[model samples]
Target: MLISMTSEPELQNGVGVQDSFQRLWTPHRMAYIKGENKPSGPEPTDGCPFCAIPAMTDEDGLILRRAEHAYAVLNLYPYNGGHLMAVPYRHVADYTELTAAETLDVAALTKQAMVALRTASGAHGFNIGLNQGSVAGAGIAAHLHQHVVPRWGGDTNFMPVIGHTRVLPQLLADTRKMLADAWPVD
Candidate 1:
C-alpha cells in the first residue's frame, strides 16, 4: 500500500497520510529477512533449499544451467536484476570442503553465469564471490554457493539507498528463461 502525501499535514500524522512518493511495497521480502526457508541443520536432509533445488525441474528451480558437480540458479531474493548463484550439488558449508572437481565446476559455472548475464542483459559489470559462513553473511550457511550479481550503469540509486528497495523490471521466470537461453554451451 502506497501512501502519497499531497500536503504538509500528511507528514505530521505519520500514519496513513497521503504522500507524493510512489511506493513499491514488497511484502515478500519478509520471508528472507526472517529466514523463512533457511536450513534447520547442517545436512542436505535438514531442509536445505540448495540441496533440494536440483530435484526440481529447471523452471521450478529457477535453474539456468546444470553441470556434473554444480548448477547455476537465480537468487530467490536478488540484490540486482539477473542475480545468480553457482551452487555445488553437495551440501558443503565452507568453500574449503569442496572437492577439486566441485571447485572447478562451481568456478566454471560462475564464469558462465557472468557470460550469460552479459549476453542476456548486457551487464556492464558483476559482483561475484561467496560468503564463507553465517558470520560472513551467507544466508544459507549450511551449503556453499557463489553469488554472481550483474550490474549496469546507474543500476544503484535512491531505490536501494534511500528507499531500501530494489525495482526489478522482469519476473524471475522470464529472467530465468533469458539466462538459460543465453547460457554458454559447454
Candidate 2:
C-alpha cells in the first residue's frame, strides 16, 4: 500500500519510491522481479522454470504426480513445510483460458497433493487458493496456479506480528522428495 506523498512525477526507471515501512525482499528476488536476473525477457519461452521441472527432474524441486496437463511443484519460499503449487502445463493467465476439464484436473490434483503432503509432513490441514490477478498477489500472473499450503496446530504465532519472519523447518528439496515419494501410483 503506497500513497502519493508529493506532486513529483512518477519514477520511470521502476525503482519505485519506497514506502517508509517497507522491508526488503531477498536480493535475488529483487533482481528477478525487476527483470535484471531473469533468463527470459517479458514473456516465457523455451526455458520456463515450471516447464523444465518434469523433463529435468534433477532440478526445480518438483514433488508430485505429473499429469498430461498439470504438475505440482514445491514452493521455494513455503508458507508451511509442505506448501506446494499445482500449475497447468500451458502458460494460461487465468481461469477463462482453462477448459472445464483442465480446471477439474487441477482440482483433482490439488486434492491428491493435499493428501500426499499431509501423509509425508504430518500436516493437519491446508489453505488452498489461487490469486488470479496481480491485485490478489499472484507472483507469476502469466501462469495461473493454485497453492496448497499445509497447516498445523501451533504453526502460527507472534512471529509474523513481531519478528517479521517466517520459520520453515524443511528445505524445498527435502519436502519435494518426501511428497514425491508419497504420491499415489496408477
Candidate 3:
C-alpha cells in the first residue's frame, strides 16, 4: 500500500495561531546575491558593468543623466526606491585616481542626482557617500561610484529589519525614466 502525502494539510496550528504574514518573492535579487553582473577584476574590460553601462542606451542602462566625464545611473540593487550613483566614464578603482575634470563632473552630477530624486520621488533627505573597497562594503570595488540614496521618514520598516528584504515599490526602469525626465536642464 502506498501512502499519499497529497492528502495531508500543509501545516497544523493551534486554535489561537494565525498565519497573517505574507511573502514578497523577489527572485531577481538572486542575480545580485550571486554576483552575476559584478566585475571580474579591476580591469575595465573584465566584465565591469559600470564600464559597459555608458556604451548602452540610456533606457537600456538605466542611466539618468550623462556629463562629459561622468554619469548618473539608477542602482541595480538599490537600498531604497530611488537610489542613484554618480560614476566617472573612465573606469578607476579608487577615488584618488579621478582627474580634476572627472572629479568635478562626478561631484556636479551627484548634486544633480539629489535634485532629480527629490523632484521625481519627493525624497525627504539623502545619504550620499562611497564605499572605497570590497572590505569597506563596495559591491563593485573595481569602479568608483558614489551612492545617492533617498530617504523618507519611517522608510525603514519590519521588512528589512526582520525579513532581511527590501520592498521597492517602483521598477528600476520606471525610476530611471522618472529621474531622467526630472533631471535639471543645464
Which ten residues in a row are the worst by lDDT in model 1?
1-10
Measured by lDDT, the strongest candidate is 1
Task: Highest TM-score: give the candidate number.
Answer: 1
lDDT of 1 by residue, 107-181 (tens): 999999988999989999999999998899998999999999999999999989998988888889999999999
Residue 110, candidate 2: C-alpha displacement in angstroms: 0.5
Q: What ranges in model 2 sit over 4 Å off?
A: 1-42, 46-48
All candidates: CA RMSD in angstroms?
3.4, 8.7, 7.0
Ranking by TM-score: 1, 3, 2
lDDT of 3 by residue, 64-177 (tens): 999999999999999999889999999897999999999999999989988888888899999999999999999999899999999999999998999798888888888888
Q: Please give the lDDT score at residue 123 for candidate 3.
A: 93
TM-score of each candidate structure, all chains considered together: 0.90, 0.74, 0.88
Give Cα-based local distance difference scores for all models: 0.90, 0.70, 0.88
User: Which of 1 and 3 is the better model by lDDT?
Assistant: 1
TM-score of 2: 0.74
Root mean square deviation (Cα) for candidate 1: 3.4
Residues 1-186 of candidate 2 have per-residue lDDT tens digits of 122233343467865664554342333334444744223522567345655566766345454677778877877656677888888877687888998777877888898897787778788888999998778887666677899998888888875557454666555677777888887664
